[model samples]
Target: MSDSEQPGPPEPDDSDPPGAEPSSRRGRRPEPIGDGVGAAHRTWLEPVRSRLVASGLTLDELVGRSGYSKTRLSELLRGKGYYPSWEITYSVVRALDLPPWPLRRLWTAAAREAAKKQGWIENRIQAVQPLGLEQPPVAHQAFTLAMRAPYAAYARAFLQAEDRAQRVVRETFDILWLTWDEACATADVKRHAWQMLRSRVMARTLQQDGHPDLRQAAFFTAAQAAIIDLAERSAHINKMAGFFDAVARLPQDQMDVIVLTHLCTIDAAAVPGIVGLSPAMTHTLDHHARGALNDLYRQHTWE
Candidate 1:
C-alpha cells in the first residue's frame, strides 16, 4: 500500500472490553477517584432516585419544589458529585414527599462511612492510642504525658499565670476523659486538646483580669510581671521572659502564632494545624507579631 493509502491504526475504541479496567489518556490505570464518600452517597441515594422515577416526578418538578437547579438535582440523582450537603438532601426528600427517616438514616451512614474512609476518625484514634489515652488506665499515663508536653509552655505563656495554666491543663484532661471517644475520633487529637486548653485558659484569664477583650488587654505588662515573678522564684528562669512578655502583648491571633511557632518550636507550616488558622493567616499573624515585638523593644529601650 502507498503511504497516503496506508490504513491508519484501528480507530481508538471508546468502550472498554468486558472485565477490563478503565485507562486514562496516558494509557495508565485510571487513578482512583472521588473521596469514597461519594460512592456511599450515591449508593444511599439510589433508592430515593428510584422512588422519584416511580412517582413520575420530573427534574423540572424537583427543581421547582426543592429550589435547586436542574443540574444540581440531576447530579444528586445520578450521584455524580461529592456527598450532598444536608440541606440539599433534606430538600430533595421533602420535594419527593418521602418519609425522611429512611433517607436520613442512609445519609448519616454514608457521611459517617466517608469520614472513616478519609482517616479523619481513624487518625485521631491512632493519635490517642500512641499516648495510651484510649485505655482505662488513661488517668496516670495520659495525665503525666500531658503535663510534661512542650505545648504546656505555650499554654502557660498564653494564660500568663502558672496556676491558671495548670488548672486549664487539668480541666483539659478531665474533658478528655469524658470525651475519650470523641477525642479519639477527632483529627489531630493533640492539637485539638491543646486548643481546648488554650481556649479555657484564655476565657478564665480574661474573666479574672476583667479585660473584656483579649485583643485590647495589656497582656505584655501582665506577662512581664508574671515572668518576673517566675524568674524570682526559679533558678531555671531565663531571659526569654522578655520575649514571652512581648508575645503576650500581641493580639490574640498573633500571640497564638508566636507561642506555637517559637515556644513550641513548631514548623511554620504546622503552626496553622495546631492553631487552627489558615497558612496565610498564620503568616500574617507571625509578621505582625514580630513587628509588634520590635516596636515593644524600642519603646522599652531593651537593647
Candidate 2:
C-alpha cells in the first residue's frame, strides 16, 4: 500500500494511576503511561507533572499563571482527550518555571506520534514566538554539519516524518552544542554525538510487541524503490516485515549495527564511528546480527 494509504496505530486510552484520587480531588496524582505510543506522552508529561507537584501551586494558581482554564490544565496533566498543542504546553511549562528545551523536544515527539500535521505543529510553535537556541560553537559546527545527513537518515527511517526527523536531529545538535566542552573532551566525540542522536530518535519511535516498529519503515523502503503497483508493493512490504521482525529480535547493539548498516545504508567502516564502537566490536556485532537473523529465519520457515 502507498504511504498515505497505510493505517496509523490505534490510539491507546489514558487511564488514571492505581489508587489515585479522583480527578476532582485537590491532591490527585498524575496518571502513569505505559509502553508503546504512550512513551511519547510519558516523556514530556511525567516531567511536567513532577514539576507541578514540586511547585505546590494549586490548579487555580496554575490557571492564573498559565492563563489557561483549569479544565484545560487538568486535561493536559491527566493526558486525556487530545494531545495538547505546543503553545498551551509551553505555557504550562513556563508556569512551572521548567526549562523549555527538553520539554519542547519531548512535546514535539509526542505531537508527531499523535499524528499532528506538520503544518499544525509549525504554526503552534510559531504562535509561542520565542527566542531560538544559541548557535553551535565554532569548534562543534563542522562535526555537527558532517553528521546531520546521516543522523537525519537514521531518524527518518524510524520516525517516518521528514519534519519530525529533522526536528529530532536539530534537537540532538542543540544538546550537543550545550555540552560541547564535555563532548569535545570525550575520547570519541562522533560516537558521543551519535549516541545522543540515537537516544532522541528511539524515544519517539513506535513500538511493536516491545520492539521498535520496523514494519512501518518498510513503507518507505517500498516507496524509495518506486514500487508503484499496489499488489507488488504490498508483497514487498510483507516480505520486508518478516526480515525486520527477525532484525528486531537481535541484541540491541547488534540490531543497531544491522539497521545502521543495511537500512540507512551507512558504510561498515563508517558505522563504528557513528555508533561509538571500536572497529572490531562493530564487526562482531554485524556478524552476530546476521547469524541471529539466519537462525530466526530457519526456525520460522521450519515451523
Candidate 3:
C-alpha cells in the first residue's frame, strides 16, 4: 500500500465515548518521573511506616506472608530510596488493619501528578464548573499526581483489608466491651457474641488473603479505636478476662464459633476438631445466635 493509501489522519470525532485521559504529550515539559519519595512522600511515609511497625505484625512475617523480597522490603522500611511494591506493601497495610490514610495520600499524589502533566486536564468534560476562586492547575490540583493504576488498585484493597480486620476484631468484641459480667452469666449473650466474633475473625483472615467482602468492612475503625483505647487505659487483664469469660458461657452451637474462630484462630471448614458444623449450618447458627444473644442482653446487666 502507498503512503496515500494508508488511512488519512482520522478526524477527532466529537462522539468519542468518555474515558480516562491518555498518557500522551504535545509539549516539551519534562515528565514528572518520581524522584526519591518527593516532598509529599516525606510528609506521610515515615509516620505511616512507623504506624505499620507498631501494628502486631513483624516485618519478617509480612515478607513471608506477602511474598515480598526481603532485601527490598527492608529498604522501604528504612525509607532509604526503594519504591514500595504494592503487592507486598498493600497486604501488610491491610493485615495491620490501619485506616485508609496512607492509601488516600497515594491517590491524592497520583491525581495531582497526572493533572500537572496534562495541563487544562479535561477528562470526559463532565459538567464544566465556572472557574471558582482558583485557576487551571488549581491551588489544590498542583499537589496531585497520576499514580500507577495497579498501585492505586492495591491501595484500595489494602484499605478494605484494614477495614475487614478492624471490623472482625470489633464485631467479635463490642458486646464484651459494653457488657461483661452479665455476658458471662447468660448463655444467650455468650452465644450471639460468639457468632459475631466468629464473623469478624473469619473476615480478618479472609482480608489477609486478599478477598474481603466490602459489606462488612466499615464499623471496625470507630469501634476498634474506642476498644483499643479502653484496653490501653484500663487494666489489660480486666478486659481480657471479661472477654474470655463472656466467651465461655455460650452454647456448644454458638460458643464454638468464638472458641474455634477467635481464641483458637482456626476456621470451621479447615479445622475438623473445632466447631465441626457444616458451613451452611455455621451461617444459620450465626443468624439465630445473634437474636438469642440480643434478647439475653435485654434481660441481664451486661453493663
Candidate 4:
C-alpha cells in the first residue's frame, strides 16, 4: 500500500455482549487533560520566548526568518491548544539564534510529559490492529513507535550534531516503516527498534567523521570539558556531565555495558544479547565502570 493510505482504527465487531466496550477499551484509564501538562508546556516554552525577546526578534521577524506561519509560531510560543511539531520548534530556535541543546532538552521533556498526560502512545497503539495480523500494517502506528523509541539516547551516544541526530531519528522511522512486518515478529519490538537505530546512527557518525577510529581521545576530552564547564553552574548538570564524561572514557565493551544497563536500563541478562557479553562479564564491566567514574571524578577535582 502507498504510504499516503494510512490505516484507520479497526472496525468494532458487533458480536460483543450489550454494555461491553471494545477490547481496546479494557483496562485503560481515560487520559488526563489537566493543569499539570499545561504547566509543563508553559515551563518548556518560556525559555524559547525569553530567548526570542533577548535576541530582539519579533514574531513577525521570526515568521519571516523561519518561513513558518505567524499563527503556528504564535501557538507554539503560547504552548496552548496543541503541541507544536518538532519542525516548528526547531525553526523557532533557529530564528532566535538560541543554542539548541538546553532548549531541545526542555522541549523533549515537556513533550514527553504532555504525551503521557494525553496517553498519546497508548491511544496510537490502540488505533491499529496487532502487528502481523491479516490487516496491512499502519504507517502511523509504526511512526508512533519509532518516535517513542530512545533515539535521543542513541544520538547522545554517537553524534554531537543536533541536526544530524534529528536526521538519524527521521531515517530510523522511515526504515522502521519499511520493515514493519519483520519488526512485528520480534519478541521485543522496542529493543529491536533501538538496535536498528543505534547501528544506523553509529554508521552515519563513522561516515561523517572519516576517522579510522570513531572514538577519538581528543574529541571525547573536548566534549567532556564542555560538559564539565556547564556543570560548574548547575549541580545536576555537573553530575550528568561527569557521568557522560566517564562513560565516554571507558573502553568500548565497558561503555556498551554502562549504556545498556544505565542509560537504556536493560537487564543484566539482556546485555549479553545486545552487546555479546556474558551476564558475569556485564556485571564485571558495571563494577569497573563505576570505579572508572570515581577515578575520573577525583582526577577532574584534582586538576
Candidate 4 displacement at residue 275 in angstroms: 9.6
lDDT of 1: 0.55
- How close to the true structure is residue 53 of candidate 3, measured as C-alpha lDDT? 45
Q: C-alpha displacement of 96 in model 1, angstroms?
A: 37
Clashes of 4: 0
lDDT of 4 by residue, 1-303 (tens): 433244434423313245643232222322233343464455446556655655665555666788876556655666545666555677776676654444444555566666533344334334533323222247536545544445555465567666777766765554554346556777766657667766766665644233212332224443355655554535544555555655665775677677656655556676665544466877898888878877766544312
Runs in model 3 deviating more than 4 A are 1-36, 107-303
The TM-score-based order of candidates, best leading, equals 2, 1, 4, 3
| Residue clash pairs of candidate 2 | none
Between candidates 1 and 3, the TM-score winner = 1
Clashing pairs in 4: none
For residues 49-129, write the lDDT of model 2, one tens digit per residue. 876776677776777888876667777887876778787799897887665776676677778878876666676788897
Whole-model Cα lDDT of every candidate shown, in order: 0.55, 0.74, 0.40, 0.55
TM-score of each: 0.35, 0.55, 0.24, 0.33
Q: What's the C-alpha lDDT at position 130 in model 1?
A: 32
Q: Candidate 3, 180: how far from true, in Å?
A: 26
TM for candidate 2 is 0.55
